[model samples]
Target: MSTSAQGPTSDESLTPVRWGVLGASNFALTVSLPGMKRGPLTQLAALASRDIGKARDAARSLGIPKAYGSYDELLDDPEIDAVYNPLPNHLHVTWTARAARAGKHVLCEKPIALSAKDAEALVDVQRETGKLIAEAFMIRNHPQWQQARDWVRGGQIGDLVSVQAAFSYFNRDATNIRNKKEVGGGALYDIGCYAVNTSRFLFGREPVRAIALVERDPEFGTDRVTSGLVDYGGAHLTFTCSTQAVAYQRVNALGTRGRLEIEIPFNAPADRPCKVFLDDGSTLNCSSARVTSFPTVDQYHLQSEAFSRAIRTGSPVENSIEVAVDNMRVIDALFRSVESGRWERL
Candidate 1:
């Protein structure tokens, strides 16, 4: 893998991270691959799909250099510096470990692993191999989220008090991977994660407890909708996520002085500016806002850049393994709260 255009850095010896796609999933084609393509510090070296024809098609469509029939073949490629694992949720741990063991950096799709234990084990492997590993939570790297964080931290919204957020999408395709219970399919894993991660990210703190009321489908054994409250220090957050509802993503935060609200909170494109609601009943809208946005502005690229930068700079990121594990810990407790009919202390 030849190096792509490098960013302006003091360390000239550090090469651009040559990137490879591990699956031909919709997200890979529609979101992450495009994000990866836009970054200067990364190169789209290859792509792997179970079907050779599909891989070839994706390679042609995306202008990727190489296409492979098997993931291992892509992993084995000397030119490939990193692999993006957009495989099914259950397959995340296996491929991530395999890629790490093969001496390649990994960027796996979220809920990083099925459990905190698996996430920890994967982190252990990355530590041993001295390779980078990250979960594909695009919001973490988006400019809008960065701005939201700044507003809260800078007292644009004084002394944050409460939060209300929701993300929902109606997809009734039983054949879809998200509807398959055997493969980590559910509203929680598919979209509720946005609500969970968003609340955590925006608040910049850990939840003390979680209370949930889940409306489940008997045939699918998956919750159709989940509404819950998460306590963060002195703050309280209320959220809902669903797979059987009209698509929507919204975040409303109330502070002692004022409140902030966003309509397209997560998965927005990078170049687009996110609208800001300030006190004094005035609106701050950004021309950067684009209808075509989908969470994170070149966020995967930023994510990839951050991982490589950490590799080069030898520092820890906020989205470290321990952080991923903590995210899962909250998830676990939330599910338990749903089942136990009471608030689950986190």
Candidate 2:
């Protein structure tokens, strides 16, 4: 629950978290690292990559102070406060647990673990270690989602009746991990998780049942596309995700009294516009009215800031580890439904 009254704290006095990057993933380079640079709540202290040359290059390119050739060495740095885990899907659990055991707070990449059981284990480790753990689903911290959530709860769209969403991108590169099932690469775990998370966030309720059809390639051994219907209370959510398709992502809501739609809603800037249509057909579109910040803002930065706040001040995070675990449970059930060709209970 974000409060408008909690206006941006003065930067000079806020505690800055020292962050270490565990991998030089594309997402880390393009989004997360830049966001961290822009944030007053964090400092990029170190970066680690298996390849020393790549690690050195990333460190030089990003202007980070230290580069380690091993992830364990980065973890052992006494000055580091937290880690941003951007490893492969299969590695999320093992590395997150190791970070926890090292007494380091973690903001791991989404789908924190491949299975619900593993997700729960990660949460349990967080509890035992008394460290803040957040999955790097930065969209949850973005203003588009925050405003949309407020509208859904405030009845701006009246009674929420249905949701429709899609997220996809072309991924023909066979060498990419997304094409490997053994490593937890697939459309549902990759982009489809966005649709699922967005739908659940807007509804603020868990689905009771799910049905899905997944298309798999024998060579890749992973589902290239997955479509599903999730029943949340009386509401319905229809979603599709694909790695074989061209890029397209959107989340739309149909309500009893009106409709609400967001273009690039999940990954939009904090100042991005969100549109609403009333039952009478009146339309209004405006930027995230809550944030009066200048220029554009990074959701990753905001998320990291919030997580740091949680660590230092004991403030609760918007997306708790419990929430991530529950979400993974829902996703696990969806996968089960696909396997059984039957409705799966969540």
Candidate 3:
């Protein structure tokens, strides 16, 4: 496996982290493999799918060295240093544990598990296996989000009071894993996790309580539309996510004296530079806005680099299992709030 051109390609002594992907899912094939290939620390090593032909085709497309007809085969390979688990939400914890027990570091996609309780099991898995396991929240590593947080902490937005975000996309296909109720399909789990995760990121604390209104799809039996308010006691984070609406995403942090906005918060494009706006409370229409644009970056590439670096150095992963479990607690509370019709205390 050769190093990619995106990072410090001049470092000849650095041994690349051998990575194996759990499944040949679309996100893994298109987004993850290509993105990781762009980073020098990663070596596109092995890919696995239930079908050998599909796995081989995917491997050939991305130039990954090995293809396995079963996930266990790739996990059993000693050369693979880490595993990227882009499996469905329900399978996240199961496969993540398997990879860890196989003595491989794992990066599992979010929402990390079906429930907070289910996600908590990985805490024991990591400690017992002595292997690092992390949740894949690529946005946390993005420059735009980091800058936004830095500005907030620096008082650029004085006394951050509230965060507002919305993420939605129309997908009602019953066959899609995202719409399948049995497999943990819903707005809250799919897209709303970003809203919940980002709000907590800016707040620098877990929400104290949560209240929500969730509307389920009649046919899919999944939460199609969910609006939740997470109270951090003094500050609040509010967001709405929908699986049956037009595709859109935006995040704004409003402080006592000013506001900051992320134009394309979630799903920021890799080809173009992204922008964030800062405004004094002099106007509401963003007329008094000061704009800052970030250079072109693939957050996924940065994410892969960070994960592999952690594995190589024996350091902590960026989003540890503990962090993922805390996020899950917030999501669980919001769901409880939907049922109780009252604020659920976290």
**Prediction 1 TM-score vs. true:** 0.88
Residue 58 displacement (Å), model 3: 0.7
Which regions of candidate 2 are displaced past 4 Å? 1-12, 269-295
User: Model 2 over residues 1-346: C-alpha lDDT tens digits?
Assistant: 1133222442447788899999898878887788777677788999999988899999889999999999999989989999999999999999988987887999899889898899999878988998888888888777656767787899977899999998888887888988988889999998888877888899998899998999897789788889999999799999999989888888778888766676676566544443332232253442332222223556777888888877778888877788899889889989999889999998
Regarding TM-score, does 1 or 2 come out ahead? 2
Candidate 3 colliding pairs: none
lDDT of 3 by residue, 216-267 (tens): 9999999999999999989999899999999999999999888989999988
**Number of backbone collisions per candidate:** 11, 0, 0
TM-scores, in order shown? Answer: 0.88, 0.91, 0.96
**Model 3, stretches more than 4 Å misplaced?**
1-13
lDDT of 1 by residue, 308-341 (tens): 6666676555476667778887788888988898
Better of 1 and 2 by lDDT: 2
Ranking by TM-score: 3, 2, 1
Model 1 Cα RMSD, Å?
A: 5.9
Which portions of model 1 show Cα errors greater than 4 Å?
1-14, 270-272, 280-296, 315-318
Candidate 2 residue-wise lDDT at 176: 92
